[model samples]
Target: MKCILFVFGIIALLLCATVQAVDKSACSQPHEIGPCRKADPKFFYNSEKKACEDFLYGGCKGNDNRFDTKEECEKTCL
Candidate 1:
């Protein structure tokens, strides 16, 4: 019973991990907008379109445009 419960818990955790909540306006920096691609300018992830249409409409700006990695982008952009 304990082993089965442990396995189930692990599976549940993995399933939860797989579920990613898309952020429409994840980027908050004014300068760093270039790097981060607009959430869904043309393509819509799943069924819901990105909330921040402006972000997508305008090209990446400032630091966002410069960094490659998310962390780097955040640091530079945000």
Candidate 2:
């Protein structure tokens, strides 16, 4: 009984870690500017600085790290 409980606890902890990792995966993406000539301003979470920073984004394909506002980035990443 005690061993079973311990195994269950370990499994729960691993699941929590995996969920958290998935949730934060977008925040872990590097800032991408894409291959365009647009100067649209955007915000992204800087993992190194642990804060949202602004950057000019192209009007094409980019990663999920882009956000329209710093508040939105903070809400998602922080």
Who wins the lDDT comparison? 2
Clashing pairs in 2: none
Candidate 2 stretches with Cα past 4 Å from truth are: 1-23
Residue 51, candidate 2: C-alpha displacement in angstroms: 0.4
* Model 2 alpha-carbon miss at residue 69, Å: 0.3
C-alpha lDDT of all candidate models, in order: 0.39, 0.92
lDDT of 2 at 51: 98
TM-score of 1: 0.29
lDDT of prediction 1: 0.39
- lDDT (Cα, tens digit) per residue for candidate 1, span 1-78: 999999999999887655422132334423233455554332112113212222242344443222234454333223
TM-score of each: 0.29, 0.70
Estimate the TM-score for candidate 2: 0.70
Count steric clashes of candidate 1. Answer: 10
Error of 2 at 59 (Å): 1.0
